[model samples]
Structure formats: C-alpha cells, structure tokens
Target: MVIFGLTAVVVVGGGAFVAKRSYDNSKIVPTPITPEDFGKIALGDLYAPDPKADAYKAAAVTAYKKDKLKNARKGVAALDWIEIKDKGPGGDGFPQANFPPGSNPSPGSNKGVAKTMLSSFGFGAEQWGCLEKLWMKESGWNERAMNRYSGAYGIPQSLPGSKMASAGSDWQTNAATQIKWGLGYIKGRYGTPCGAWGHSQAKGWY
Candidate 1:
C-alpha cells in the first residue's frame, strides 16, 4: 500500500509539471509599442491628423503658386512693344500721289491712299506689296468695282457693296473710305494684309 500511494503521487506530480510547461510555452509575448503608436492605438484609430504636417503641405502649395505667378509676371514684362508707323500719303511710299477727296481717282491714286493708311492699322511698308497684289486681283483698286455674280464690291470685294457704308456715306465713290473699310476688314479677319494675301493665294479668295 505504501508503494502504490508513492507511485500515484509521482504520476500526479509528473502530469502537473507537463501541464505547467505547456501553459508557459503557449503564453503570448507582447510587442513593444512606440510612443506615437501607443497614442494612435489608445485613440482606437491608426491614422491621426498631424497639424504640423498639414500646415507644411499648405505652405508648400502657397509657395508653389506664388512662384508660378512671379514667373508669369516676368514673362509678361519681357514682351516687346509693337511699333506703328506714320500716317498720310506721300514720302517714298508706293503709288505716291496727293488726291483731293472730291477728285476723280484711279487705281494708282487708290494705292497711294492705302499705303499711307497702312500704318494706322499697324502694318509696315513691307506689307504694301501683298496688299497691292491682293486688291489688284480682287478689284484692281477700283472704288466702284463690283462682282456681278457674287455681288461683292469695292477694293476689298466685300460680298455686299453696302458693307462699305460703315466707313463713310460716300463709300460708293470715295476711294479713301473704301480703303479704310477694306483695311479694317482685313485686320479683323486675317490679322494683316500679308495674311489676307496668303489666304487669297491658296483659296482663290480672301
């Protein structure tokens, strides 16, 4: 009986030791938490708003916009001014002649008026050759020139003759008035006389 009791006590002690060892081995070790991570975890959110970071991002955006605006202003300041030449007929310009307003005029006289007026619309004498050629093909610089089929009229060959009335009441008879309307039309549509000439050359019409 003494041996049996001793054996039972040993068996129970061995089982207790195995159970303790298994419990120790199964225990989880916690990872060390950084101060920042602990704060986030304590707040129950992984992503916390950082005021300093937000301010830095906002400041960087504002600085980029200011730099972009400064460069734009510099670009604007670097642009060159366009020079406009003198007005009125005569002095080494093409088809040079002085014609009184009421005088009967020819194509050459009409060209004289056009050359003087070119500068008013910011064109140089270099543009006159193209202007002359364009009008010569369109209406031969005639104030009363008319297209029977298209109803285009005057030096610029405006589709309707009445369109020249915007320049003056005597658009039908006055070469200067017709030239003014024509130049204004050319400027609005083609930017320059040469541009109009180029379009006319390519398309057979300006």
Candidate 2:
C-alpha cells in the first residue's frame, strides 16, 4: 500500500540492488492458485508479480474471480458484518477480521463493505463523499487494477497491495478489510476523507 507524502522511487540501483533482490526473492506467483492456494500465498507476489506479470496477473485474476463468483452470494451477505460506528478501541476486530491480508474483494463489494465499515467507525456519508470520487477516478472501482508501467495493483492500487497488511493483517479481496485500512490511512495521515481527496487531487495520490 502507498504511504503518505511520497511517490514510489523504486530504489534498485547500486547497493540497494542486493536489498531489492532480496525483496524480489520473497515474491512467488502461484499458478492454478486455488482458494486453498491462498493459505500459502505470498501476498507480495500476488500483488506485484515479477517479469512475467502479464500472464501471472491474468491467471491470478481469473482464479480469484472464479472463487468470488462461486461464493458471490455468500460474500454479498458478508456485508452484513460491516457495521457503522467504530466498536471502540480495538475496533470491530483485532488480530482477526480487523485487518485481513491481500484479499482483493470485487470493486462493487468494496463499496458495499466501505459503507458498512465506515459507518461502524462513526462516520457518515459526509466523510465518504470525496473518497468515493477519489477511487472512482483511480480504478473506476476496479479491484484488479494494475498499472502496466508501475505495476500498481488492487482496489487501493497499493503498488504492491501486500503493504496493506501494515494497516492490519487482512489483505485479501475483502473490501470491508481494505476500506478499513484505507480509512485508517486517511485518518493517520490526512485526518479526513476530504483531506485525502484534496491531496490526491493535487498530487495524484491518496
């Protein structure tokens, strides 16, 4: 996930090359990746594949989409879990659903989940209005967004959605999960949805 105040400068030159290589080594894109495959998934690899990203992304998206389609109705109902108004200090969940990992929920799911999650955090539409436009413009709400050049990926276009875990552990295709982290990011850095929206409008990021 993108952090505040800076554009990514992939520092792979000179001495950083070794470190970069090490980081690269942690990535692994699995083929025929089943939902079972996710248990062992390297979220880093899934979000930012290596040189063969085109093919890898296609397969990843296909597999994930199929999985969602299979559980579409159930996942749709899962939206019920997202309640508005932060459930206090630890929030709705702690080390569990509070922050899942690399699971990119469908864009439509993301919206529904956001509404639910944000509401749970004591927020109303006034807080979400600008954010709605920010991502609508960035990915058109596409959870699988991948920049051909920069390789930014997923709903938040986290460049490498793996970084989203820092907001919590949930990173899969769970929109409520992603929205939780995204809202946290906005609050931590910019303090409000409209603030983050303004920054993105001015600097091409949010």
Tens-digit per-residue lDDT, 1-206, candidate 1: 54344334334443342344235433524344467654543442322233332332233233333444555777844211111112111111112133345655489888999999999989999999999999987777776665322335578765434445557545556688889888887887788999989987875566
Off by over 4 Å in 2: 1-106, 167-170
The most accurate candidate by lDDT is: 1
CA error at residue 126 for candidate 2, angstroms: 0.6
Clashing pairs in 1: none
lDDT of 2 by residue, 13-126 (tens): 222322342355335332343554344343422323233433333333333333345467566521111112111111112221232344433667678777777766556789
